[model samples]
Target: MSQYDHPTNRDPSNKTFEPIEHYGVVGNLETCALVSRRGSVDWFPIPHLESSSAFSRLLDGGGGCFAIQPVDPFESTHRYRERTNVLETTFQTEGGTLRLTDFMAPMTDGESEISERTLFRKLDCLEGNVDLRIVFEPRFDFARTEPTLSATTEGVHATGDETPLCCWTTFAAQPFEIDTAASHATATATLTAGQQEWVGVSYGEAVAPTTETCEQALVETVDYWREWSHSCGNQAECVFGGPWHDLAVRSGLVLKLLTHDETGAIAAAPTTSLPEEIGGVRNWDYRFNWIRDAAFTVQALSNLGHTAEAREYLSWFLDLCRTTTPADLQPLYSLHGESGLAEQTLGHLSGYRDSQPVRIGNEAADQRQLDIYGELLLAVFEATRSGITLAETDWQAICEIVDYVTEIWQEPDSGIWEVRSEPLNFVFSKLMCWVALDRAVDLAEQQGFSAPLDRWRRHREEIRTEILDEGLDPTGSYFVRSFEEDDVLDAATLMIPFVGFLPFDDPRVRATIEAVDDRLTSETGLVYRYDGPDGLPGGEGTFLLCSFWLVDALALTGRVEAAETRLEELIGYVNPVGLLAEEVAESTGQQLGNFPQAFSHIGLINSALHVSRAKGMAVPGTELIGIELGTGATVEAVRDHNHSDT
Candidate 1:
């Protein structure tokens, strides 16, 4: 084997991958894929991001997949084509070098056209004569239907009892070969230097074959990514010449794609029921956006120069805030602010690795996590600042949200990670409550939004002082995850610096970082939310976004190179496809939880912009050191991570 190739190390059964194997991600908001370093497409869900997956090998390789990568599988190298979502992965084989470029045909003008039926994958040979392989595999219903493969002049395809819903692609560059074990067809093509080949793995219900060349699709895709990335301009000095900022802006554009453009509902990620722990019941569907995530989504977008996106999300959020019965303040809500997310399980499909009872809805929608109030208000305050004029009724509804926070800010509840263990007075949730009231009071005074300023201010200060004095660990300089736990530290509280609750350089904030890093950081260098006794069973992958948050924390706290080093290392963790799973198992290198998470991308956006602003460049189109979303917040990095109450 070439020294540059991945070492032929012992293959441990439990560990199927590395934390950094997921190098590229591509999706249409309805579904996404995690491409590995070896040019393999591992995880994908279709019809919708939240729909049952058509390719789910990320959770279990025994599941469905259509892997068309370099043969004699080995580690592949990947990178994004500067400032765009287009991912280029080069497979270095002992025989020759081959490159595969992957990207979704972005919508025109960088604006998502929901209901558009399309997904694109392109292959290019960079240098050296090499053989390119293609696989036409359709494991419909997740390997349930035994598809019969047939090669035709048009292309190779799968026809089975499931019928038309199960579709495959054809290739002219290579001949089709069938694999009896995986029940799939494969193709191999030989290309000389500089030869370019185009392949499409498209699906439609007996639709017309494309007369449109791959060149047309490539042009359209480039137009879409370029236009969307146009909004990435404008930020302060970040970690470097704006790698993080660029990542954040691109990530935001991707996240926006998952939203129902018509209804403003965003999916949490794009895949569902992928477990955080193999054989563990932690698997849940991330197809629908939770209110908490929407708040962050709006916050990240508002600073990225996306006023329209902020307005659209705020419109949905405003409607949610206007919910009557005071019971509407749920820990989780649908993208449209729809409550009552009834939970269900799909028993027909044997779970990935028998991670039984794949779930569809979130039960946490019924949980009364106090943090939602703060997240809701924070989004609204941004809306008001972003040129939104609230009506009198909306303002009154804001007061009610504040009132609810005032009454329950002190109550114990599940923290942001939604630990199902037991309710506690989560410090992060309380701080957000303070943010809600404080922003409300500020808006009423600064933007002329009508509200009861005096009461809101009182509640705000009350929360601030209470957290400062009572939220601390007493023995340590840091705060606990909850008032109930004496030593349970939470990385969620790291946002104290992020939300302007405390400056990044504050000694106490530094102390909290130290505590979290020391306590929650894994041996593999990833961060966890915390290890307090939550109501879950199996352990989870590292909270991928928390690690980025640490990178942001390190940079803002003057550890520039350290922050850069961490950021670089973390970036390496992305799959070969430039997509990230919800979490990463540090030891095994496997990704856990949902695919192409929004929370991870949102954090990436904010952290990148945070780095940019720290270096003093806020103008749109400025040469920022980081990625700048036109919105206010700079994302230090982007990962497809997500969160919820169990």
Candidate 2:
């Protein structure tokens, strides 16, 4: 092996240049941290996703960060702990091989409620000797407040806000130094072969953790994840069983991490202000829950046999219904069900890649998106089908929503895309409105509920006729984006078959899919959401979710081989640890938009399941041996088991 000085800090010139896909996600369900492969905790929310961020280096260089990485020039690789959300990154250096494990311990009771606010990390020297450095910086409230740092016998304490955060390590704290001017702390350490160290950071009111306690928490965290994975049951019983089983499970975990355990609210992503188009003005906060996104997420989880999540989301939905009329329902809400998420720009910092106007709350919450009714109805219908008994109150709300759809189906409103333009008769929106009535009529018939079936049937038929008449092009070969613009092709039209508006084999549906493939797909097979404007100026990357949609459409149309090939290619777009972002830049193939996007993962799960069933593949089953971490069993042993099976 060779010897060299490790890279202690990011180069001054390239501080904020890490690609969005270059990071891995680790969360304790209450909150999450985005750790770059280079070992920086760049983006993390304190206490919860909706709370102010304590580490915002991802958005701006000087914002804040907590990092521990090799100071030498080295190559590294990373993966998640087997069947768990824990992350492991290994650096192969000239002097030695160093492995770092990162995780937020899960609740031991194994319930969804998250009470842990600590991010745990362990470092081991696998060979020779290596040097490393650690940096801890906290910028509470988006860097508007700086914490005063002081060292304690337990570790370093950052006191500024009501609740202080403490960073503790197993080793003596001799190497640490408080950089008062920069509002951060730094440390350096050297490890020989076979040596290891444990470190952690915790916020909010809690006892300062000792080395032994952190170690025990790590063990419990592994057990928590393994039990949850085991609870998923045999792979043979899943709708899609193949080599993608592990990826699918990981995607499910990603979706779960973004959900608020208590309220069942699912955020679109666990981040805010990450740009859809780098250096463009399209950045918006996604930390809140959107009714449409959450509905789709619940349905996906239900399909994956995690009906608990589905039931929870429905309960949350019922709460929203109690406080809302169908006509006045907002498109999105805070995790606790607040509707006023006022949008604002934080002018203090530069965005990722110098993108300006870092945004906070989402203004789209107030948009008149009519497609959410369809999404909600579909979620309820799915939950009811999955043996989740809907409350009578839920049924009543469903009926009210159907009645509202009947009155508003003819009116133009923001479509599924949430375009800011004047409301036009978007074909996708009309199709989903039809879906609402169609599914509502079925629910009433199946449950023998007292819904006005005749009225619903009449309106459903009318909406279908209108779509066939106006939503379709003059040649009737394909559906257009909107009635006002009949020539434009839209990727959303490809959902015609998936939502049962038309059969996959229908010539019109097939032509629409082909049209999108021809016009919206890049050479790399990534699909654009659309080519038209959304009343916003900059261009966005190819949407990852839409690409997955194409995979499902391809499979449903009997193009099994093509769909399988496409699925494999899309899976390649996942980050080093199997997480996906909202979009990928067509020009560079770099991920864009928010990191670990729930919708992108949902698309992966749905499309993979669809294609796997179509191709007649069975999920390969692996025997899971729960490793007791404190019993001298190495973390690597568990990772090896999962890697081999996968």
Candidate 3:
């Protein structure tokens, strides 16, 4: 018998959650699954990204999973099929070598259509004979409801409260047994050299797979992903060329996967309740679309020459704006643009790595994040600059949003980090408010759209004056996190230069960057969001998004070489399959929080563009949007000025 055939490894009771970085993701642009290196589908939400998980082993041991692994002990390595989201895992066992290909097929004949909910797993014995085992266990509704299992001619059928799941295989006669008490199914098979087999599962009315159908699906899915990636500007034309080109493309692909194709909404991340600090209460759901995150995502994709996604997202946001007044606009919403995301905890399930109170929704949805208006308007401004025309109603929505910002920009509210403490006058929030008015005035003048341009211009200058005066430290050398916390340092202020709030050569911008570098940076150069109390207990890992923002800050200030080095160090934190989590542990270098985070990837894309531009490389689509690279001063001149100041 093989080593894996032993009771300890084969038994479901012995299963444990894998590290957040141990898994690679595959999706159909609607929902995604996290497949571990051990060949287990541990976290999969059926129907939609925000729907109840069909496989929740990532959260609790009792949460179910579907795994296919060699019966023999083996070492495995995996990668995505070139330019596509299809994942291939190769296992090297003493008995033989085997390859496992996993993907969620788009199931569409054309690019414009939506995809069916189906996952395919194909196996090939590349060398000698090999023995394999298949375990299918699904805990529907976060394990609250036990699914009724029945054997089928093709494989097994599981009926639960949400949706029925059908698992089928191509093995002869489909030999598998259902354990009704445990609510799981199991099967085993052995194949000789060059032999192949397939396993597939579908949700709802999708047809069960045969070997031929699975093969066809693989080809179609690969083609779809490759075509989509190519549309994001060919690698030859990629502004970020050299060692960072492939990484940039992969980040684009991840952002695309998190986006809902039908609704044009982008998820913050594919998973929920992955803790920022292990065993901490900082975990929150990220599957919903935050207007702040989606706006950033749209701008990043548009800069990469993928303007269609930008157009779609703008259309969706405008539709949402039409239904509500500016005061009622939520910080986040469902993929279909609905709000009311009441936060709740799944008490029955243990969180990832015993982090308690696994959460399902986000309370930050109800918080007043004034920064989203700036982000949304900036995205709209960039979209129009990229040649996307807005309809009259869309322009009307933009006007109302800008007008609303004029009234509330001075109010204290939740900062960009969504602190749970009482609202304070956050510098980042105020900065984005400035961005909203600046872009609004420019858009109105350029497009000849009627608006209160003079009022917007006045507010824009007033915001700049306020930030320069009260938003600074007592020494007046650096920007503070908020006016309330004058001594605290925040990394979000790194974007002041990127947003054109100040010239790169401005002494305050330089001082703010240096202050964050000295106070908030980890030993590994990763950046923490802030150094003040956030009303939450326990410390979290350095924020990846903030780290990338620092990268941009460095590059845009005459520190191109320093930015390149920091960019390389940050890229080293990506998982083996080129995915980034929300945060990275400073002590152990382990990734923490949600896997395949959209915000992190968005930051990487924008930073790459900034660095490339700083290096005097030609970046497409940036000229149209007027991305400020620097103050046109030579690096030596800027360095000399800083030296002389010192």
Q: Indicate which candidate wins on TM-score.
A: 3
Cα lDDT tens digits for candidate 2, 570-616: 99888778899899988888889988898898888887677766674
lDDT of 2: 0.78
**Which is superior by lDDT, 2 or 3?**
3
| Model 3 C-alpha lDDT per residue in residues 557-589, reported as the tens digit of each score | 677789899998999998878899999999999
Which candidate would rank higher by TM-score, 2 or 3? 3
Model 3 clashing residue pairs (backbone) = none
Among all windows of ten consecutive residues in candidate 1, which has the lowest summed lDDT? 637-646
Using lDDT, rank the candidates from best to worst.
3, 2, 1
Number of the top lDDT candidate:
3
Number of backbone-clashing residue pairs for each candidate, in the order shown? 65, 8, 0
* lDDT scores in order: 0.64, 0.78, 0.83
Candidate 2: C-alpha RMSD after superposition: 8.4
Candidate 1 TM-score over all chains jointly: 0.79
Q: Between candidates 1 and 3, name the one with more favorable lDDT.
A: 3
